[model samples]
Target: MLIKSEQQLLNFIKYSPIIIITLIAILINSLIYIQNEQNFEKDLEIYKKNYIESNKRLTKFQVEKAYKDIQRERENLEHRLENRLKTRVQEVYLTVENLHKKYSHLEEKELLNIIKESIRTIRFNDGRGYFYIAKKNGFSILHPITPEYENNDVSKLKDSFGNYLYKEIIDHFKTEEEYFGELKAVKPNMGNKKFEKVTYIKLYKPLDIIIGTGEYKEDFNNEIKNHIIREHIQNVRYGKNGYIFIFDYDGYQLAHVKKEYIGKQRIDLVDSNGFMITKEIIKQAKKEPGFISYIGSIMPETGKPAYKTTYIRGVDDWGWAIGSGFYNLDMLKYLEAKKKELRAMNNESLKKTLIISLILSAILIALAFYISNILKNFFTRYHERIENEIQENRKKDMVLYQQSKMASMGEMLGNIAHQWRQPLSSVSTIASGTKIQKELGMLDDKEFDKGMETIVKTTKHLSQTIDDFREFFNPNRVKKEVDTQVIYNKAIQLISSRLTSKEIELKSDIDSTVFVTYENELLQGLMNILNNAIDAFENKEIKNRIIKFDIKFQKECKMPNCDIKECSQGKEGYITITIQDNAGGIAKEHIDKIFEAYFTTKYKSQGTGIGLYMTYEIINKHLKGFINVENSEMKHDTQSYKGAKFTIILPINIEEG
Candidate 1:
């Protein structure tokens, strides 16, 4: 037997190369199969992760997009409702403001009674909104919703949430001039059921009453939200399991995929990681739309705890957060089944892959370097071209501005000529008289003194004229509190000679007390308008060349116009100056183009259109005031004629400090 075994071993060794090659092939096949199997499992895990993430993103997007639409609608309703309420309060303030101005001289008690009666009768928004008044001590003076509460002290009044509603308003006014805030109150139409309401309170200092208005905020939000829920929000759907859920910013669920969870408070609910999931959802939803992953959730299919990935967004208008989510475990089963099939196919592919591995590895390295060089050169050229173009455009703009200023200076010189003519003539006349007196041997001491004084005063007047013009044209960016009337007088003074020579009747109703900033700038702009009106008169044959100034001062207004008389009714503060002329108003076609630079409605010798354009810039850009021109028919002393009217409205007071 030993002899036979030894012979067998020798025979196996004789063919050992062939046997080893066959055995190695089998082992290599097994190793490749195992690696491919491991790779398929790894790929499946990656696919599962990607699949879950994709679902999370899609669900979040759908929920957030739908929530955004609902939120936008809610906001619009809130804005409209709030504005309606605010406008109602403002209108009351205006009426009170007007009455205060109108009855400023009346006895306090009598004025209060008249104002109270007027407020009680006034209604807005088709009688849905009304105004009321309370004293600083929280004494209800005139409440339309709660008449029983009227004539009663409400300093201790509290809302359903235990907030001291009336005391807050009164105390707020102790340190503030105006108050706009929220409060809780009962709705008359809702059977006195408490709802959150917005209130605007202002201390009417004249009557010592905290005047206010209130409207139920929740009622408006609900009406808007219900419309959205019915028409759009509820219909939103994404993946097989995805649906939007709604909750207030405070985490009170309004809508959910699980019907039983709706209307439940979940702000304090935590996930497996102990994170306040609902609170975080509400917080994130209130800002921009985003994704969040938390470990704990109640599964929609099983109604059991599981890891959930959610997407959330807030609807700011209704103070609600809306979101949707999916469970990771649901995706696991599909991934596992897919992985099993993929492993066998991968194992087969791996056997073929080794044949070309060396060839592919050599080509990839060369391709990467070539692509990197090309990208670098392309971006470098692109950046250079963009920067060069920007610099060229900036230079061109600077040149245009300089040319405009130069053109304006040429026009100012002509105004100066007109201004200097009178002073020059007076000085010439005084000198001629003095020379004649000396030549005729009648230059007595008293006569010499009088002639000398007249010449000196005439020369001084010319010097002052030059100073005023120089100061106006100076490029000084200084602002000071200047009376509106002073600026007007200065402007008229600059163009007075031209208006007189043209036989223009200048009538002014200036309230000299109102003050503002940018005195010289305002003067220059007014001068431009005045000069335009004078120029407009040259072609017309109208008899009365009347230029009128109607200036008014108000205490609480902005951007005054003809309609402001009714809108502000002198209840707000503003300064309005209307400079109009009977020069047969500008042609309708040319009115709109009048403010354009280099746009002229005159013979080339008569005007450079830059005057009005510069005037527009000065008033609008420099003084922060509004100036507008219109062609209208005017009546002066029973004579009706057409002309251009320029109205300027500016702030009442500007603080220099």
Candidate 2:
């Protein structure tokens, strides 16, 4: 045999109710903890959705603001270009007007000198050098730096240059308006040398003349191109390790970090080494409105992929698209740092939730088992005390029942004496009549018949009286369906002897057809109430002590008189036995408590309080009927006496099994 060790005993103690409750408390607490964790997860999801939506809205707002800024800058540049062009046109117009006004009245030499001075002024203000004056017959009159061409029919010179200049001047003369064109410039001294130039011609209307000015294309473009590019580049911010490029409307490279690529068309920028990014920038800008990343060859100095974010701005008037681009690698570094911080926070929250859940579950389970043990001990004590009180009450009820039985026995003996009195007196009278008839010796046939009839009637009455008393005192258990009239008749018979001795007149108005399920004990209960009524009347010493027993079907048992289904059984039938006497009525204070056990106004020897209590018990508990009492005043020849009326209301057929 093995003995249990201290550790084994300790283990068993740990598994006891207190310990079990601790475990259960822990389980419930864990459920609560897990629920809190789920709630946190739900909140996190909501935060994430809201965060993403907010970022999207912010991105949209930023893009719209950027687009507006680009539009504003473009508008400003266009406005400046427009003002400069308008001022230049106005100055040329003014110079032509002055030339015509001064030369209108001059001689040929003076007019020639004025034309040369005007050409010099045009050259000074307009950045071009060549000018001429022509007559209506296409003869050249004044030529700056070439005075040999004076009075020459220069219009007839067969070359594109001479034709363009002559036609432009003649057209302006006829229309009296200015004309502009581009043409090749030729001079005899500078043979085979070509000049690309712009011409502005105006008619000398007051003098039938035309004056023309020409500006070289190279000189005019040189004035504005560098300034436009410089202004655009200076405002662009590339941050660090990133570069910017600017492209013109035709996808040509206008400016770039690699300055050598400037002015090169996009298609021609590709080198033998295949290091070009202009085509890639243009392709991305055309695909989307703003910022996209694409890979391309990087400039050699940068040593990074030309993976860039490109932005396009359209020049609406020219149907051109301008673009700017930046490299991609610099933007990613910032996003990576934010992602690491979020992951760290998520891991810390998860670890905290798991640890808290386990601790709480253990605490909750212990509390549950501890409370269960305490409640069990409390209820066990309460039930034991209740059982002891019930047994004590039962003993008192038995003693009271025995006392009631002894009192009934004494009343029964009184009833027997009263019952024997009438029959005995009739027998004595018959015997006396027989003795008198024999002494007189005059017993004729008529006298004999009357005496025998008298004898038979007296004997029959005596036999019926004995039968009624015998049924009342019978001790056998009765289980049978008894008629309502039989029960009432029996009750009257039991009380009849007492009624007669007290000179109380007994009258019955009973229904013959009603029946009920009852025993002799119910009849005895009704007799007891009748007996008390006889006593009350006789003791009061009223002139006429009359007890009326009425048995009939109760049409209305309560208000509205609706038949009770369980009691009436489809017929509006109930037996009401009213026992009224000319006795004094019960006092009002004692009426309600008359049915309570050990509650009576009569002396203890005269009446046990349980008479009506037993009557109520027999009718309600055994016979399934009801009893109530009311006081009524009796009138005899205009004299009224108060009497007690006891009503026994019973079902026509009480159910039995």
Candidate 3:
């Protein structure tokens, strides 16, 4: 029987090797498949990173290039507008000079006829078809072809063109030089229609006079407006949503893609870009030329990102800005679409590459599986040990999370205790006083009413204390605008009893106008610092223990040295509150760690070492402000006392900090 069993075992081993090898091959194949999946994921991440970076660069380059192109176009338009004005002014000057020479030998009536005939020839030859001449003393003469302006004084006129011409004539008289330029105007006779008019002046030395001629701007070469309109269209065509427009220095629409907008008073348009065209551009137009970009809403639009990039250049002759811009979004969409397409193609290619990798991985896995079966039984016991270790590690993680929660709870509770001590004492004292007065039989009707009122007030205070604690613990409140004075008053009220108990004198220099944008619970944070100051003063034996709280409204101040991220630029105002105490100051080495959680100078039982840490969190993270500490000698009367002062500088407009 023994011989027969041995022969059977040998036969079993020979035939079952194929089956065992097949099972091991399957296990190895699964392991290789998992590894290949991980590799594909890593590759996809790399591809995405490369694709995003490339597209970001491309978009930035395109935006910069477009900005430059618009700048060049604006410069060209401004040059053309200036040259046109100069040429028109010269033509009028020469024509008027000839008329003066011819009429020098004639009498008043024949001279007038010659003057009238000369005006006709000048108006026809010069781009301005209708010409009007006004003397410095307010006499007006019109060309024979257009008799409307004859014998009219233009000095009292206040329209854009009239005002501009008046100023140019005065300047020319003062400088004794020929003055020529374009002025924006709205003529009353023309139904108050606005127009850009070219004005020219030449001195008549014999008459001791200045003769000023003005021609309706539209009657001149139309290229002045056309150039402006073309620039606007180019900028608008490249932009995303809105069209571009140009305005003269006086805030009159010179040219716009929309026909109705041309020659309109831009100041009346709610969303006009005229406000952004600086006075410097106008002032410098005659001396130097340049372009500037500004944030302004497109005409006839409301909402954010409704801004257009306006490029302005100085027109020397007209003293106007040849400005143009398109809506920002309109210019950005094309690049955005290109980026999206590139991202999509990258993702698709990545997916195909992953699929190919998976197929290759499957083949490698199949080969590995066949080789692994030979040793599978040797590794089963080790796999069980690893699984047990992983389970133990998970349990440890759960324990750590629980401990962290308990630590946070303990710290929060300590802060609550510090905050509530004063209110609770006030309630207790008021209750005891009420009872004593009633029991002593010394309370009259009025006195009894007063005592009862005190009790009610104390009860309300206790309720408020509870509410304050509840709010501090609740972390879901949204931030809103808050009055800084109210916050300071509340902190003073909360710490009043504590200050009394410790015999610490409280002083405040709070500003009433200081307002802040923050969550309500931020008041609790300030109270925490006041409470700590009270504790520090009480713990030490310094005489005349005092806590000085000052709230200053600063137009601009640096952020405090706390770990808070500044919420806005330092341009806006800030509420700076300084809480100072007259106790022994903290050591220099410990000041740096004062805001770190679980690090405190107080005894283990006295403090959880989280009050200042939580205060830092509230001031920095929640309030979007900063907190800092300084140790210096404080003077009370003639005596010197050393204590720590905590200064919190919070932005009044958090958005600008």
Candidate 4:
């Protein structure tokens, strides 16, 4: 019995873990299914909302496109019509003036008769236009359509629309030479109709007659409205059943695809949801042409409550609001189909997931133990690899820095050659003269000594050129106080010969001498900048090549304008060095990139493209100064020239020990 109790306790301990794990797995699966169901519901809601909003935006876009197209057509028509009318009126004016000139020599009655007869026969614009004569006092002398009104004072004649036709014409002609008006007028073969006419009046001073002719606008338009309605508006279709419909701003339905709905008042019409559809559409249209939405109009195929999105636009010329609509039933149908598909997929996936989860649950326990041990080794190796990569990167940076320094040294060598050429030529010339003097029997002791002294001085200058550049490339980090003026002059001396060769004048001003560390690097940077200016003058036809340096002292601050912010807080001032050159300035596109490594505007053979880049890095990093470059009009003395200005803001001496 004791052995049996001990065995039973061992069995219970071994099986208890499996039983508890199975229960937890069941509970976790149930929670996962519930959470997945909730997430699917949330996602479906979001998708439906997003789809509806996107459809609304699409409908608005369609409406605005149509509005722009129609407005453009209207403007084009107005422009053409105005030009045509002016041209037609000018033709009639020239004809009447010629006739008046021809008949002016006859007797008064004869002249009047001849002029009237000549004007009566003239017709233009396909016989729809004719000449008429009127007196300055508003009496009609001739009327082509109405002969009886010619002898009568027809100035007070009112059209069918209560517009005083002749009186308005005479009043307009009193202040202007021409007239364009619309009125009820009699055509030759047709009865009175509203006509827009352009009339021109010529004052015949000799005969005291005002001769004018006008063309009917209806004839000039030539079926433009019908063409626009048929070709432009009616045929323009957008989605499956989308179409344009027109209504006046006051809500009179003028044109629609469904013929029976035309001529109906829609301002008070409501959708199935009781929203005032036409009122909202017209209100939106009357503002700038844009889109408005209202739910109405059922889908014919569905025969259900359908959502419709319409875009509305106003036509100011005809006082009409036009729009098109897209039904949401298509999207709804797609959504419903997708929902059914997703539901089926979810059910299938749930069955598979439950079976798979049971299988995976067993494997997960084994992997948890196995992967932890693997992760420990992986982390150890990963840290070692990262350290190695950092070291490699540091070596690469040093290599790049050395390469850049070599490139700068090569550029300085070119400047050195330019500096030594003149002195070497002078030494050679002096030696040649000394030889010629000895050969010619004119050699004197004092002359020979003077020549020898000059040769020595020139050789010393050549040696000093080498020394200046040799110290520039030294990698020693030595800090010493430097006067700003002295530093500027030293840099200038290195490049002065090259400047002279290019005929570029150097101008400099140093107001206060300030001290800074890394004086040689500063001088090197300044020399590199001056060399660039010198190189820029190559092949340039600037009348006066000039480079300028201006130095001043400015108080430095911890923050911007710290003097006003905190009364007692301050730091040492800065030596501000400005270098400018008049080589027509750097091109604007390349100004920002000039300091970047391997970026140069010069030929590859002429430049290695690291001189200015090293200069920038040296000033900003080694010397702890700020440098900025821009292209602007630099004024030197009395002349203003477009040039590049480089400003170097350098800190004063910081070493205190």
Listed per model in order, the count of residue pairs whose N, CA or C atoms clash below 3 Å is 12, 12, 14, 0
Write the residue-wise lDDT of candidate 1 on 87-189 in tens digits.
7777888898999889989997678777888989776544545788878888887877778878789988776578776676777788897777787776656
- Candidate 2, residue 496: CA error in Å? 80
Ranking of predictions according to TM-score: 4, 2, 1, 3
Where model 3 places Cα greater than 4 Å from the true spot, the runs are: 1-458, 468-474, 558-568
Q: Per-residue lDDT of 475-504 in model 4, one digit per residue for the tens? A: 777888877777876777777767777888
Give one digit per residue, the lDDT tens place, for model 2 in 1-657.
243753444334444645555566567557755765676566556655554454434433433444455556556644554454445545654675676576667785686567656654454433335557777668877665466667788666556444444565565466566666676665334565767766666665655566666555555554444444565442444445334455655667665666777777775344344644455445545555554444644633466555544555443443334554444443344344544555566557656755665566566546544654555555466657766876887789778777777776777777877877877788788778877888899667787788778878888877787788888778775667677677776787777777777887777787776565566777767877887787676346577777777877765565133335424441445777788877788889888887899787777778767778888888776776777777887665577878788777676666652
* Shift in Å, residue 189, candidate 2: 10
lDDT (10s digit) by residue, model 3, range 1-657:
243543354444434554555565555555555655575556555655554454434433433444455456667755654565456556655665677677778775565456556655554433434444555555566534335546766566566344434554665576575666776554434654558876666665554445555555565445534553454443454323334445666767765555676777765344344543445334444355333444554444434535544444455455455444444454345445655665576567666665665576566556555545433543454667866887998899889777777766765565556666666687677668767887997657887687668767767866777676566556676656666677777667555656766788888887877454555557667766877787686446677988888888888665444333463533567788888987887889999899999997777756777778988998776677788888977888988888898988777765522
After best superposition, candidate 3 residue 70: deviation in angstroms?
38
Evaluated against the true structure, the overall lDDT of model 4 is 0.73
> Which portions of model 4 miss their true places by more than 4 Å?
1-29, 90-141, 146-228, 249-252, 263-319, 340-359, 365-657
Candidate lDDT values, in order? 0.74, 0.62, 0.61, 0.73
**Model 1: CA > 4 A from native:** 1-414, 556-572, 603-608, 654-657
Return whichever of 3 and 4 wins on TM-score: 4
Clashes in candidate 3: how many? 14
Q: Considering lDDT, which of the candidate structures 1 and 4 is the better prediction for this target?
A: 1
Q: Highest TM-score: which candidate? A: 4
lDDT (0-100) at residue 139 of candidate 4? 76
